[model samples]
Target: MKRRSLILPVMLFALLALVPLLATLGPRSFILAITTRIVILALAALSLDLLIGYGAMISFGHAAFLGLGAYSVAILSSHGINNAFAHIGCALAVSLVFALITGAISLRTKGVYFIMITLAFGQMLFFLGTSLAAYGGDDGLTLAQRSLVFGAPVLKNDVTLYYVCFAALLGAYLLCRAIVASRFGRVLRGIRDNPVRMQAIGFAPFRYQLTAYVLAGMIAAVAGVLLANQAEFVSPAYATWQRSGELIFVVVLGGLGSLHGAIIGAAAFSLLAELLSHYTEHWAMIFGPILILVVLFVRGGLTGLLGGGR
Candidate 1:
């Protein structure tokens, strides 16, 4: 809410917006491509922060929505329906319905039970995706073409798609900032910090938490749509528990409870992985310890170090 609080995210987006231009100075397409992936994944991580950070709901299966969205695009594209609007609509619809059903059942539990239930649901989706033999099944499916905008394959252009994804990340960030600062956000946080107290004051914690869950799922689905386009493929792997863990890591690595921290964390994680992989195939061994150090020492993550852990 403060001007100082806005500075980091604004500057981050500004830098990201310039990346396509910056790419021209070097590896060009490769740099632009990786940057686009980071921005898309950042959007997914930002959505998770809405639940885990502000709402205190740890969903271990959130990536299911991402897989659903990506599959929506992949399936639709395979059927010769390349419309962007259709892909987005189907993605959001499937994720919204799935989140509503799963969140309803999962919200009945608390703490670890809630986490396990979400993970179970996520795995269910993962298996379902695997069983879709019509859509390439466990091997995954490739899109013959990216979604078209007004019959134009605008998203097929790397630079154009990069900018589009950049705008999406920026837009998602602003929308989340608004949500976390709104009356609804207040109710969500109240439920997060003290659910019993909130209920005593006439706020139904289940309703608010479920709403936040569905909202977060829908946002993640948006990221999935972008990711499917970015990769031109959809796989069960996208919805795996491991992918969910990475989203959690991104949120934590950037510091919990801060929206922009999600973006920073995503960038840091992506770049770190890219950098580490160049030296060793088993980069996770080294990357794992760095994450541990961040958890033990960083406290609030990079945002905390930068004094923006709000």
Candidate 2:
């Protein structure tokens, strides 16, 4: 009973911490813009956290879903299909099918073998995206128009787009929280913590892992759609292995198992990139070292740096 009272305080603290950031930046400033990007990337990171932190699945091909989702919108819009629903529906379905097929096979292996299989699949997907001659082929496709949300221009305004992304980020956060606490989440957690024990209790580890993988893929696809919308372009670079590494970086940065940490990590990573890039062309060289330092000393990430409230 006493422990339950801690929740409100934690929530209030997190909200309060944001006040400083918000107060210091204008709506049109780079901070806010980067923050929105953080939210978008966080959605992808959150999905990876489910597979890695909770399910113990090391997926190196996760960005394939992102690429698939991005391409779905780009390809459809190229043919004059601009409805948001149509693009999103096709993206989700395709990503789910891909996840189901890949997860089924990848879940059969473990450790380095699982890692290699997923990496191989991701590379296959990357090359596949690079082969679409109709959509810029090796150069990638540029989105001529953004999807129309029910015929209304919900995403035409930068502020509106940011809010839409924020809402999606909020929804993703809530959904993840609910999922992590639900019965299915418990089983997945059980499998992660003790696969042998879960199987001993008649629970099939592969089945749960695969289900989680598919769900993660679907969510990751949603992120892909938002990301392409955010960037206003689709490219093979979307499916790069380096992007997958960044997703894993967020999972670890936010402290494994803390869903909201994904958001914080994304904001940190993106904002850092933006700020650093403003200084020089060799920004990534600097970013790499910083990431290494974080992994070495920080351990839990920004949320942890903030006392692990949310």
Candidate 3:
């Protein structure tokens, strides 16, 4: 990639890093909160882009990993195990297992069937969360405290948490970029473009695609861990089909196959929804049409307008 290609992503992160200083000048603390939320969701959407953009897998249940991560922290914290490493480990393990099982089954199908199976699995997890009465069930669960970093309340501070989220986003972006540029990425892209040809050449597209699916799940789970801490709560709704739609929208709105597009899309979607909700409770009623117009007209997404390609 050219140095100029990185300019936008670098500049965007720089702007995000400065947000804490800007928030200090204003009395509205919600600015920092919402900003953190966007970055967290951006991480989740970035994971989805890895599958949809690079692997040509349109998963409709990616939010299940997010919910799993959040619930992992919540459930573990409820048991007096709120260590950051512990939460992350549990979240990743569970997401990996879930993704392996679901992806193994879902990848057998193609196109709309794959989508429906993923959606079905996500809904199953959503209902499972709702059934856990000991963990607040339908009412959701609140954390007694955020995950502890070496027994310190690092994430308890908003600014510290914001930087942590920023670091995670940066790390996720770099890792995804590296993966997409590697020989493995080439094979995945080849599979996406021509699975039959790749199969003829001795590459098992199923195995490669499943690996990508599991990796995406694990990454999304990390976002969920941060999300649970940010909100200090976990809910079944986090894994709903609707949340999956929002993730897909973020990946698509930013442009498929471009990792940076996921970040941009998340930021735009979060800000747009925030602005619209103040005017009406049924904000989606308005936001829906706007999103449709973007998909219909913005052929390459916001990234295309900015002159980047996958």
**TM-score of every candidate relative to the true structure:** 0.99, 0.90, 0.98
Ten residues in a row with the worst lDDT in model 2?
1-10
Candidate models: Cα lDDT each: 0.93, 0.81, 0.94
Q: Regarding TM-score, does 1 or 2 come out ahead?
A: 1
Question: By lDDT, is 1 or 2 better?
Answer: 1
For model 3, residues 212-269, the per-residue Cα lDDT tens digits are 9999999999999999999999999999999999999998888888899999999999
lDDT by residue for model 1 (1-310), tens: 7789877877888899899889999999899889999999899999999999999999999999999999999999888999999999999999999999999999999999999999999999999999999999999998898899999999999999898888888888888889998999999999888989999999989888999999999999999999999999889999999999999999999989898899899999999999999999999999999999999998899888888748
lDDT of 2: 0.81
Q: Which ten residues in a row have the lowest lDDT in candidate 3?
A: 301-310
Regions of candidate 2 where Cα sits further than 4 Å from its true position: 1-32
State how far residue 27 of model 2 sits from its true place (Å).
Answer: 7.4
What are the clashing pairs of model 3? Answer: none
Instruction: List the RMSD of every prediction in angstroms.
Output: 0.8, 3.0, 1.0
Residue 97 in model 1: shift from native, Å? 0.4
Best by lDDT: 3
